[model samples]
Target: MACSLCIGTVLPILRRMRRLAVLLLLVLPHGASRGLEREAFEVYHQRRRAVSEAHPDGLILLLGYERQEAQAVRSPFRQENNFYYLTGWNEPGAALLLIPAQGDGSVYQELLFLPPDDPSHEKWHGPRAAPDDADIRSQTGFESVLPISKLATRLSRAAKKRSHVYTLFPHRAGEGKQPEPDRREKLQTHAGELPIADIRAQLEAMRAVKSEGEIRLIRKAVDASIAAHIEAWQEIEAGLYEYQILGPMLAAMINGGCLRPAYAPIIGSGPNSTALHYTAGRRRLEPGEVVVMDVGGEYAHYAADLTRTVPVDGVFTERQREIYDLVLYVQRKVIAAVKPGETLRGLTHKAKRYFDEAGRDAAGEAMGASFLHGVGHSVGLGVHDPIDFSQPLKAGMVITIEPGLYLPEEDLGVRIEDMVLVTENGAQLLSKGLPKEADEIEKLMRGR
Candidate 1:
């Protein structure tokens, strides 16, 4: 079907779906009755148990990284979603350890060493959630919470026994890069001086699998994200400035139920959309202009990442409709390819060919290179998470289906994203409340 016909037919149904979805969520039983503390502790225990069973004499380390000091818009020192999922602690300077059960009789093998609240620091930094006896017991399922200063001596002892040590240490981005320096050096020094077996692979292997608790938290994040996109769509205007829309878009996510933004919101209007990773949302939108807003929300600390491109005028021009439908086609097809035993790398390769057919390479570039980024990343505690590339897409894994076409010279970029959870049968769309069709978006904006 022609693009115009497709939009005319599909838009109304999508709008109705959005309305019904929103309604259902309002009446739905919110799973939030279970406090966050207990949920987080449960998730950590599941991961630790799996890892411990595999390597009984191992020491597992979970580290939370802080934002670099110099950057103005640094992400707050959020723990690695994986670390937070397992530790149930959110603080700038914190660490968690899972010492093995030990000869089947170690009384306090599961230990959490956190920064206890100091009165003076609490006064300056606001009240920190001090780990209470109940918190230490219920939240982590750990035996005790000690001052972080004890880690050194504990590690020294673990090392003397030549125990296995697995750490979720940092890694560099792009190709052929090594792990971050501070961590790389720390791991190297510990293994060399401590006589411990480097079992980082063991932790990596365990993290690849998702627990039922992780899946639940991820679903909540997706639920919050649906409202965020709609809020951005509804508040946007033909004559509004870019950042203005950006603010309300995020506010909607928080109001809808997200605790933190999954990642920096991408709010680009008009020609600014041509730039990938456009951070400065400063354009003044006018009629006939397109706004490419890619934003997400984190709920229970799990991430829901999504992207949607729409016309600010609430109606797509012929060219806009054509491009939008093409992008959607590529996105849907690639998502359909997601199933058990599919390699993400291979999935991207397959999606690229469709992207090319969708006119993404109107100018012609390397095959699978037109879109120029990974098909999508796993979305969980972090916006972009690690997946088990070595294994298949297990039933519990959640991922994003985002495919886009960027033409800097043409002043166009369109990406449609949705969060999906891998299921035994196929994939489940978690961000089901969000509308996608142009006509649907227009009708909803008109309050129809």
Candidate 2:
């Protein structure tokens, strides 16, 4: 412990010693364009800039992440996707600052502070930023990039003139550390780690409506998911185990440019399907049994979430048909309900009514124990992207309407999901190629 503290204290001086030589090599190859990464990064910067300007007073956004555990052990921190979105620095222990466009153009107005590299450290782990990580600055287009220790100083200054700090830091916002009140030197918060509800309004207000570019990326994500699902279904057979289907499906996603799984690939067979959050790898599929797969792929880091429950063989059993049709009908009705003004919570209540109404006619006492979970959730960087908790939907919103009916006793669950985009005409289904109709799915299963 004593040696660790000595190293930490001495590192700053060591970093300064190497700063001059490193600064001279500031310019690198300058060709780090990774296709979709570059595109998404551009959109992310523009929107973050807009958020700063929208509030005018300035926003202090704090974001965090967790890492994939290393070969011996996975690291606890995976950089928050949003933080990676704006800054493109995947390292943990980093923060970004977007100072409302300077009254006069200056270098450090909108900046990013990241952990600087150390040779002794990198030798133990891996490469990190040098004293001159201008490539990071150039790629992210931030005004400047500096060490993270400077953040409180930066915030202290911004709070002097501006009055609020908008952040995506707290997981369940409005509950943690609310900013200290200083009407004389006010600080606003977006996701109020509250006691300071002062900044919550702008946080929800900005992220609720998707921009045109955001919608385009989400559409691409949906298209990739459709391709993955179709591929998963095409290889399906009664003898194949449920988890076997996930490999190829996810293959299509990676090849199709979905860099990450929207969440986990849930390829559930038999009663396993009844477990809503099943993470795959299980039971063999029987001829007449239904398979419920809730899978999603991330394209340009935006999520494409979809769920489809289908027969393992070429046809559905009579009992399967009854529940499948009911699920499809309710899902269709819910899709129709996704206009430009429905709150997910409100729409969920409406969907629950349909499920209950159907129960009244068919199963009667089932929904309580059987049809567990909500209709669906918001999808984005973190699968359930944080945005708009208290507002009505707008045009660019992308949502999934999946109304499922699960019967564990009978060993069946039917859920058909499609990602829909809110449009001027109504809703546009982005996963059109997956063939959800009973006839279409059965025929596809039959190999015709």
The alpha-carbon deviation from the true structure for residue 28 of candidate 1, after best TM-score superposition, in angstroms, is: 21
User: When superposed on Cα atoms, how far off is each prediction in RMSD?
Assistant: 8.0, 13.5
Could you tell me the lDDT of residue 343 within candidate 2? Answer: 78
lDDT tens string, model 1, 99-199? 66666456436667766778997786676544554565654466667677777777666654545577754543743222342464665554455433444
Stretches off by above 4 angstroms in model 1 are: 1-40, 63-77, 102-108, 129-135, 175-192, 196-200, 358-370, 388-391
- Give me the displacement of residue 17 in model 2, in angstroms: 54
Computed on alpha carbons, the lDDT of every model, listed in order, comes to 0.67, 0.65
Q: What is the model-wide C-alpha lDDT for candidate 1?
A: 0.67
lDDT of 2: 0.65
* Per-residue lDDT value at 102 in model 2: 52
Backbone clash numbers for all candidates listed: 1, 17
